[model samples]
Target chain A: MTTRRTRLSPEERRTQLLDLGAHLFATRSVEEISIDVLAEEAGVSRGLLYHYFGNKSDFREAVIRHAVEDLVAQTAPPAEGEPVERLLASLGVYVDYVLANLTLYRSLVRAAAGGTDEVLALYEEGRAALTDRIFREDAQGEILVDTPRTRLVVRGWSAMTEEMVLSWAEDPAGMTREELLGVLALSLPALVELTP
Target chain B: MTTRRTRLSPEERRTQLLDLGAHLFATRSVEEISIDVLAEEAGVSRGLLYHYFGNKSDFREAVIRHAVEDLVAQTAPPAEGEPVERLLASLGVYVDYVLANLTLYRSLVRAAAGGTDEVLALYEEGRAALTDRIFREDAQGEILVDTPRTRLVVRGWSAMTEEMVLSWAEDPAGMTREELLGVLALSLPALVELTP
Candidate 1:
């Protein structure tokens, strides 16, 4: 395996490796993709991949974590807006992000379905971040949910959105953001006391 | 390969094969299983496993259909009662059934996740059943939803249950039927609402 002559900045190298790993992971089954392929694709040596990531499992975890962090950073609710608008915007960002990186999202989901225990925990943690954001702010005093109930509602919403995006990714038609949010707008209130 | 000497009704044999298949399919990855193993475990030859089901893919579809049918039987909302209570009872039934036959449910999910095109179609068809039940009785009272929105919400609810049950199965300590129902209750009014 080719080795780098000089050490790159840790963050830059780690980010590059994660990007390369995520691409490999998304395009094929995790078991089918080897560390060698990942390292070679990134123009880094296998030794460097190992040195930075420890092993294949660790590498996969880092890739998933990086992808999740990107997902969260991109989809966070706006710092200020109409509660409904912010919530809807956040959903739009999330759905768009999934659409943009469909392969990586699928890989992450497949890993959760049948990957290592560590991978599954990471997936769950990824899910919890979405759950937290979905319930983070009140919809401009429209909904009045207690703390415990809010978590449950958030959980339900998080689960629902994950499933919906998966289905839509598998089969997309003319579904638009406005329509999706509109539907969610109607169904969510029925499911939770989001509005006063 | 040993063959049965005595003839049995096709329905009887089919049901038997499905029961055995459910067990086999639920416990292992679909890609990892073999028709030979299923036939051997069912006390028949490989030919018989194919004879009733047509092929391995068909057999898997049969297994999923059977599991879904069982869930439908157990969780179909009662015809009469407070809608909330009926819905809660139905949800409980689903949770209990999943708890009882997690292997079966897991296998069904796996099949849905990784199967032939035909099997995936059947999975989608089976999933629609839950949505059907959701709006079957009092649907007339609700305002008509745009087709895309309706489908999105339906598919959303369908996926949420699988994710929820899988998580609860992993850690049931914090998840309770009542808590889940409470979340649903909070959202029901908005979900099945009649537009003015």
Candidate 2:
């Protein structure tokens, strides 16, 4: 195990460092946690950590980007279920993910809110991926069509899903998991139906 | 008119200054514009501007808060219309307000995204007002009920409306105003209807 940890390839080591940083980021905001703190937490030297991710700002942005990609990748819809079922499954995963990493989710939101262009762009890239997923399936009776109006409504619905999920995830006691899933599932078809 | 400008009451003068600040903010981001520029634009001395709003941070927050209040107050729904009509009416005003103050609107959004608590809170205050307005009407055959499910859905809808409107407003040529208004008016009912 010691040899394995010491002999990780550059890419593997970088990912390991980012994973450590992401874990630290889960409990602390990006701004509050510094590169030195991350190095100390990961049991690596400052020079080594900086070498993996350039400067302080670059390191923070890289960590945020890593987390965003992880979320997007993790929530990819299931391959077997019906369209709505797949979306619900993805949403369930999303709810659990945010709930487990409450502060990490929060700080990413804060990073986006902080208006750093790179962070904001990363956030948008993640959102656009989710939004595009709603239109990805051309199932036998796909309810949503690709058009300007539907696109706007779905994008708007994405915002709704985000708000509802974040608010519910923050206070899991306040809403049932079933209700959260129901709202997410039902709102999309209903919204697209009313997009005239 | 000159005398009125010079001898305006304290509240009036403060409003006058904030209005000027808001106008300048419409064209420039909050951080990019300074107190000196605001005072110069308003034809007031820097000291007077400082007197009205203490320091740079306070002044920027005050301006943001004032703009929020302005948006809320201006979008008050009509007194004599069907429930849906009233909402559409207010939405029309909201659409216009955001349209005319595009950069100002963008700046406030940036401020919220920037994660300034005061600014974010103000933005929420404005959003809550809009959401509450949906539940405000007890008109005949009101379509929405005040339940936990409904509340969550409406809040989500509010987010949808904001995103759609902002995106639509940014590219008016991409979508017709009628289509924008239609989406806003039609989506609430569709979303609420599906909240179960």
Candidate 3:
């Protein structure tokens, strides 16, 4: 959590509250981030926290959404580089982002694995957004991949990336950063090129 | 559930009870399969069921282990064929096995997603067994993949395969079985070759 000014506009305060909630969530369990805990973290009262984000579920959902946006923006493919370079850069950033928010990343996975229908749906939506953004056009109006086969390929690749990241996160197994990044970045195009 | 003989040895009866439990679990939530329900399903008394399987938790674990064994056995690569042919055949049977036990498969996923330590550890062990098998020697003593990088590749491919099958299971999207099989089978070599 970062220090913030005590006074702000309502919209600014709401944004700050959500960002704070997301930051706290990145390292702590959801159960630990109760309204009282959040308020304490933000140096605000419980009433103020509720006034900003409604109830706890609503607040948690908002924070999750915020965190996803943070991930998407931070790892968005650069608009002005060679396509491979752009992809590699985005992947490096993505791995870093996940490492920074591993607890949140894991909870998203666990939620998808066994959460309620609403939560599972939200998890799918977040994943789809992440996957779709990868194929979005770069500055030259060129797209990396767009077709039913490639869509499936990329979605599958997303799963591969997730699995590799989680496994490597648990134990590096003497894998160097370059090798790990190479596996993630290079394997995508390798799979997509199997278009036929 | 299959028909049983009027008389069975203790070992045969125990095997039958576990198989029946596995069968019921294929389509029903774990919560629904209570001890009474299992006893009634098996045409036995509660005491008999408990005596055979220890307790409800133990019984469920055994059933899950049984299902994983079924998956491994049914999908084990045909002992004799071209490498690619062997993989395609294995993938085909694997997809069928998952379809036949979709509910059980989903629950295993859900358990891995949020189950307690013991369940999660068991889930990891089961997955490792599955993935490690793909790299084991074929009849000629040739392994499909054996290095650390290839091991990672195959494991990542396994995740991709899992995601594609689960998503396709939800809705085929007019994708024929052949196409799905091709994607899952062919993509493994494509990804493994990417290792530099």
Better of 1 and 2 by TM-score: 2
TM-score of each model's chain B: 0.78, 0.90, 0.88
Candidate 2: Cα lDDT at B47: 89
C-alpha-based local distance difference test score of model 1: 0.67
lDDT of each: 0.67, 0.80, 0.76
Model-by-model DockQ, in order: 0.27, 0.61, 0.59
Quality of candidate 3 docking, DockQ? 0.59
Order the candidates by DockQ, highest first: 2, 3, 1
Q: Which of candidates 1 and 2 reaches a greater DockQ?
A: 2
> Which tens-of-lDDT digit does each residue in B1-196 have in candidate 2?
3555357889997898888888997668877666888877767799888887889888888888889999999999888877878888888999999889988887787778665677788888888877777787733438687767777777777878888888887655356787678777877777776655
- lDDT score at residue A91, model 2, on the 0-100 scale: 84
Clashing pairs in 2: A113-B113, A113-B114, A114-B113, A114-B114
Where does the lowest 10-residue lDDT sum fall in candidate 2 chain B? B132-141
Comparison by DockQ, 2 against 3, better one: 2
Residue-level error in angstroms, candidate 2, position B165: 0.6
TM-scores of all models? 0.73, 0.92, 0.88
Candidate 1 lDDT tens digits, A1-196: 7786877799997897787777885567656556788866667788888888888777767877888888888888888877677777887888888888887787677666656677778878878876665555773446435455445555666767777776677665466556665555555545564422
Number of the top DockQ candidate: 2
lDDT (C-alpha) at residue B5 in model 2:
39
